[model samples]
Target chain A: MEARTKAEVLRRLRSVAGHVEGIARMVEEDAYCIDIIRQIQAVQRALAKVNDLVLAQHLRACVTTAIRGEDPEERERVLEEIVEVFEAAQKI
Target chain B: MEARTKAEVLRRLRSVAGHVEGIARMVEEDAYCIDIIRQIQAVQRALAKVNDLVLAQHLRACVTTAIRGEDPEERERVLEEIVEVFEAAQKI
Candidate 1:
């Protein structure tokens, strides 16, 4: 990952971590069930955004390089890797 | 997504959902902090795996098609998208 991206991811992760900690406290205190679930949902969404960013980076750096490279075999390998990932995603 | 992968993903997601419910119960009962944290960690890891699988699918179905297609402009567009994703990731 680029330096800037790395910093941003870390920042977001830290924020998420803090949020999680607060949720834990809420749980301990017997906070409202709906409120806790709502917080969890927000965290999940934030994490999804992070995941999207990483995947995009992988495509640009790894997938793009394979496609642009001269070697046919490398291109094929990249293609297969992508297919594997798709298969995995489908499982999810 | 393939049928088999789709089934698997759904199964895992259901399992995770159940696990989350369990965690919520634990919170309600004032479970041990460490234990709750451990379960949360496991859930997070499971979630990460799901994200990876989705990303892989995107790369295979979307990125691969763009790379192999005849239109240079389409390829460029895909590349730009990948770059944008990377940029977005950095902001995470």
Candidate 2:
């Protein structure tokens, strides 16, 4: 990963960790369940943005490299990996 | 939340927070994007489980109470809140 993207991704993930902690606190305090669910939803959305950032970079750099390279096996592997990611993402 | 439910929710949330930090570490290490995305997906799924746990408790306890109680306004509020939660969850 590029240093900048790495930093941005790390930052967002750390914030996600904070949100998770917040949810735990809310649970411990017996805060409203609907409220906790809302927080969980927010964290999931945050993680999705992180996914998009990482996926965009992957497509721009690694995937592009494999596609433009002469190694058919590498290209095929990357292609399969992306398909699997998207399928799993749909489940998410 | 009930004692057991509270403990379980907190435990799962702590695990999710740990996973988020792990993903941050992976980003810092410049791990493969697909691998990081897989981790993120796992975290999201874990969060969903927590949501289910909390929602179940709410329905079994709080929602059940409101339905059986005479507070029409509280019942209406909970119903609206649940609708909003499902709407947001669909977006997730």
Q: What is residue A22's positional error in candidate 2, in angstroms? A: 1.3
Cα error, residue A8 of model 1, in Å, equals 1.3
Model number with the top TM-score: 2
Model 2, A3-34: lDDT tens digits are: 78888888899899998998888888889899
**Measured by C-alpha RMSD in angstroms, how accurate is candidate 1?**
10.6
Over the stretch B1-92, how does candidate 1's per-residue lDDT look in tens digits?
86766777888899899999999999999999999999998997786566555555655567677877778789778767654543333343
Against the unseen true structure, what C-alpha lDDT does each candidate score?
0.73, 0.92
Model 1 score (lDDT): 0.73
All DockQ scores: 0.10, 0.91
lDDT (tens digit, per residue) of candidate 1 on A1-92:
97877788888899999999999999999999999999998897787667666666666677777876777788778766654543333343
Q: In terms of docking quality, how is candidate 2 classified?
A: high
Top-lDDT candidate index: 2
Best by DockQ: 2
